[model samples]
Target: MVHSNRCGYTYIGESGRESCCYRETWDDRERCIWHEEIAADETKPVEQLERARAPPEVRDLNGETGPREILDGTDVRGTVFPDGMDLAGVSLRDTDMAEVGLRNATLTGASLADATLVDADLRGADLRGANCWEAELNDIHLGEATLEGADLRAADCSDAILRAANLEGANLEGAFFDRADLFDATLSRTRSYGAVFSEARANEGTELDERCVYDHNSDADATRQRRESGAVRSDGGQASDTTVAGSDIDPLTKAEATYQELESLCSENALLSRQSQYFVRRQDIHTEEHWREGNWSRWLRARLSRAVVLYGESPFRVLSVTVAIIVGSALLYPLGLLRVSATGQPLMYPSPTEPIALVSTLIDSLYFSVLTFTTMTFGLYSPVGAGKLLTMLETSAGIVLMALLVFVFGRRATR
Candidate 1:
């Protein structure tokens, strides 16, 4: 018979001559005494062992105000929990501290490279100049923490709340920061090349140096349009829609109109071309009338042309016209066709050859038409005599053309 001392469970069995003092039966029997002892020891209360292992509180050496560093080394790559301790200059590379709280601690100059700090709380901690390269720091709260000049390159910090943290000059290259809250955090001079920030919310005045690459957001389309159209000029210039002839329009209102026109045209063209083409290809149509009825290409071309006119002239075409107008006007200024008279005075400087002057005048007219159409006033040439009437007509025509061009170009660019 064998008795378990820890739980008081007794068993009667044949002990084949194995000597064991824990046995209660009178028969001499052999048994695995060492194994029985291990089984009995495992059943003992765990609380008793925990109580025995508790360390007594030692008096502070000099009544210091911060945590104490217990471990030291360059290759110290793990958690060193001298709990409630200050571990300044400790090297904790490749350590796992998931769900651990290191509140009110100072780990200045620590190298925690490739460490896992998932869901860990490092609130009010000082981790200045730490090397945390390629660390897994997802969902970690480092609120009010100091990480100045830290090397956190390629760290996975998705959903991490780093509110009011100092991360100046930190290297965070290729870090995954999806939905991370960086409210009021100072990221001046922080290197974050190729960092993922999908769905991340950052307010205005967020420091985004040349190292950062911002992905397209839903509002990005509007912002980009405003930028490209010179509607949101960053040179401190006023956002004015003054045409070449000094006609003003609301920038935002114009953008909205252009957007709507482009959207309509694109939808119409797609429906006519794609749907009609698919239908024609799938079904056997024998008559020419049927083919004309389902003429997707012609319909698309017409719709696109209308859209182009509504939005504005094509960029290349507008550029070509502007150049032609400028050159022609310069040539025509010397001729009698284009002259600038000072205040109600008639001045005509007739050139030598009438045919040459006429040709120059025609070129000038074409150039003037383009400029008027584009609403770009060169201010170098003016009309005198009969040219004044022609200039008035061209100016009026130019205003309409410019308006149309703005509408078309704005829609196309925004879309």
Candidate 2:
């Protein structure tokens, strides 16, 4: 058990255990025999873990202020209280109170700008309007705390627990939140430009401020869309409530909502194409039973979706595929698989009347390939008897490629 000399409270538990309500560590040698059993109880609730919680205490400079009098106090700007102290409403500007254990305290309007609060246990504390600018708050626990209107600009909150904290109207520009657990924290109207939220967990009711972009591969973009759309939450915990009753919701209403959801997902199809495809396929199947019947057709469609338009997300892939087909077909002509004619007469690779170079023959073949691929009747070149079969196949492929290219371009241009 650990005893506080300042507050007269006894904290009985093992050190560093989250289940212990006490912020300070327990010393076994100082513990009584009866308190040993309480220390071993791991199943104790975190809020109820403390057997005795001392009343709020203050350690003033003169040591004369009473607990009630400290509530209305303010001038403790730089006093060092090197212990577990709860000094609410105290103005501690430019204070160097590093590694302090002020858990669950209410420090509303306290000015702690330029303070050294590294590794502080500020869990469930209220620091409304606090000036913690440029403070080193690394690994601090502000979980479920309220820091509304706090000046946290340039503060390093790396690996901090800010889950469920209310930080409305806070100025957090250039603050670092790398790997911080901001799950369910509300940060509405907060200026967070250049703030690092790398690997930070934000969820429902977590309103991110402007210019707060995350990694390309992270769920931050999706979470932003969901939160801004008011459709989904970042936590993936629950869905938003609708005004209409479930029983009374018509199929048309459900369909419209689903369409909006699919549209939103499709808009971000570069990262959400699979999810968008699922919804699109479901909707397509419901409208036409034929879409659900053919396995080969669906398989072909899935492949086409990936290869042609890349699920309506990439135009580059479509262009690359089209170029490959045209070039591949053109190369086959130079290999003597198909014969070409320039004037409706049979033409060999080595010209009899004029000696054509290998490069010239290849260029003519490419020209013919482009015409054949586009199905254009320029009549500059014609395929010989057996070559007609290859020409017909090329023509069919050209038509399909043209249609797919148009579709891809349309999606790209609209997007």
Candidate 3:
């Protein structure tokens, strides 16, 4: 036997074994007792009838329409939409409507404070000016929806698909959009203070403040196209057709095109396949025996050291010095003090009367002068007469300059 607290009645017999008491029929004596109790219970409830059968307009706080709808501005505290009906503009404070389908509905100015919308399909819905404070909207498909001027404070929208949605002037403070697809969505004037978008894809013109985190390859193609053409699509529709054709192009057509292109380039050469090109030789290719001897950190440190020495601060300083030497030689060559040897050698002090005619001779003199100043003294040429004194002064200046450069470079490298 099962007892029902609603009617204060006891259900007896094998029929009472069912899940619901209404599914079973009462025995003759039990039915008589149930009817008598119900009749007596109804007699003393005139005031209770008035309260129960009162107009819904007086009961509803928001004055919203319909059996499926709550009146607008009604305070539906802790109410639920069990029939999957529209509750647009219903002020549901602290309501629990988890996994509800409020799709394509206009929830304009609705107050859904602290509501749980986990796994809800609110796709293409107009939630303009809606207050979804502290709501849980995990995995919700809010694609193509408008949430203009809405307040989504402390809402969790992790992994939600908000593709092509407009969130203009919305306050998304402390909201989580980790791994969410916000592709082609407009976020102009949207304030996302302390909001996280770790792996979200935001396209061009999507206004973001300092709080937005983006990946390296995020919208790279679109960005490049926009930069090159000043717009996204720019192929006159032919490029789009080609792209679509490439996806569905036959293997025969691809092979024929490849053959034609190869034929034009290598008219005299022979074409080889994978098997034909597979030639093995017994040459020792200097393989490292202890490939895994060094740890990744150590290898990285060695690479960084080499890069610093070869391509970093030192190289830049060297380049600057080289440029200075070249410029100085070019300047000095016209002055007639520097002379070039028939054989390529360092610059030598020449007879002041000798005519500087040859371009090659000037280049050789410049190369030698730079070498002499750098203290690389190739010893192939020597200054004669009054030229020796000038050479000596230049060599001394070069040594001092080189020393200063080395010191500066060393300090920079260490830093």
Candidate 4:
């Protein structure tokens, strides 16, 4: 039997135990907004569970706007005397939660992945361990929210106000932080690889790792690796991972464009080395896309450029490639036509007819190769037959390599 004066919200556990916690009641009704029973004598929260489990359209049709339909002038959600509106542990995944007033709501352990929470007021909510991966958190007011261990990977949190939010150990990989206000946010040990913090306002109290970088790996694989290593959070909870199903819309192209804007952000911050690293990563992804499209010519070009100079990030590779070219050209010159400038007497490596030393002919070929590579013809040696064409090719290669070397050096020296 339940008391008629108090709120009668009954929570039935998986073990089938019906427990009714004491809550304040309305003066005219038997229950408060959170604990309001649809039926006069229904003790179990059967209708509440059914409403939560309903489909998206079904919930909309049944008015998923929450109990704000009833006026509580004395109190508002999120600012209650002791406890707030209890929506805790609700599975709101893939629901249209946009512009909803969940302020001060208790959403702990809620499955909100892929939910559109744009402009929702969730200020001061307890959202620990919530699966919000890939959720649209744009412009959401989560000020003072407790988000420890929350899965926010790939979530679009652009322009979201998360001031003073405790996001310790949250998985924020690939999450967009563009213009997001994270002032005084406690983000200790957060996995923020691939998260773009472009133009995000933060003070000294905001614990952000300056060394955070994008390593181009999936969030699930990273989480699984951490779990396999038996890692635990600061709150004495074991690290857990959740696999998100595909979203309704694939934003891969938008993500690529967003990274381009992030690249500019790095340049604005004078992080040239980081910018170069990001450029290489973007090119690698594009090259992979080309490979998937079966564009063999583009793939070959990308591979050759990467091998030659590592996309201009490695200058030593460029020098080594030039050295190899010089050596190969020198060895090939002896096999072609080589003649003295004063006389048309051809010099061959074997010297079958004349009895000239092999070493002398080889040295001459090496000298000519160096001169030909630099495009510096001293008129001491001449080339006929195939040697003329080989010298032309080597000269062109020298010109291209010298320009590339200059560009690489300038790019590295600036920042």
Count of clashes, each model: 17, 0, 9, 1
TM-score of each: 0.41, 0.37, 0.37, 0.52
- lDDT per residue for candidate 4 within 1-415, as digits (tens), equals 6677666555432233554635556447666544443342323332442332335454344344331111111112122222365555554554555665666777776667666788878899989977676788999999999998887877899999999999976877668888888778987656554567888766645664332222234343454345222233221233334222212112343334434654555566565655676577667767777897899999999998898878888788889988898888877777647788898787667856645577777788888888887888798888889988888998998888888898888878865
lDDT of model 2 at residue 330? Answer: 72
Error of 3 at 161 (Å): 1.7
Clashing pairs in 2: none
Please report, as a residue range, the 10-residue window in candidate 2 with the lowest summed lDDT.
Answer: 66-75
In terms of lDDT, the best-performing candidate is 4
Order of candidate numbers by TM-score, starting with the best:
4, 1, 2, 3
In candidate 3, position 106 carries an lDDT of: 69
The Cα RMSD in angstroms, rounded to one decimal, for candidate 4 relative to the true structure is: 11.9
| lDDT scores in order | 0.48, 0.54, 0.49, 0.65
Residue-wise C-alpha lDDT for candidate 1, range 1-415, written one tens digit per residue = 4453322223211121222233222123232221122221133222332232213232133114311221111111122233344556544444556665677677786656666788888887888877666678999888888888776756788999888888876755456778777766777655443455655545433333221111122233433333222332111223323211111333333333332322232233342232222222222211222345897775565544433341133555554544554455445444455543335322333455677756655565555545644558585456666666656655665565556557656755664
The global Cα lDDT (0 to 1) of model 4 is: 0.65
lDDT against true structure, model 3: 0.49
Off by over 4 Å in 3: 1-90, 199-415
| Candidate 2 regions with alpha-carbon error over 4 angstroms | 1-294, 335-356
- Stretch of 10 with least lDDT, candidate 3: 279-288
Clashing pairs for predicted structure model 4, backbone only? 78-104
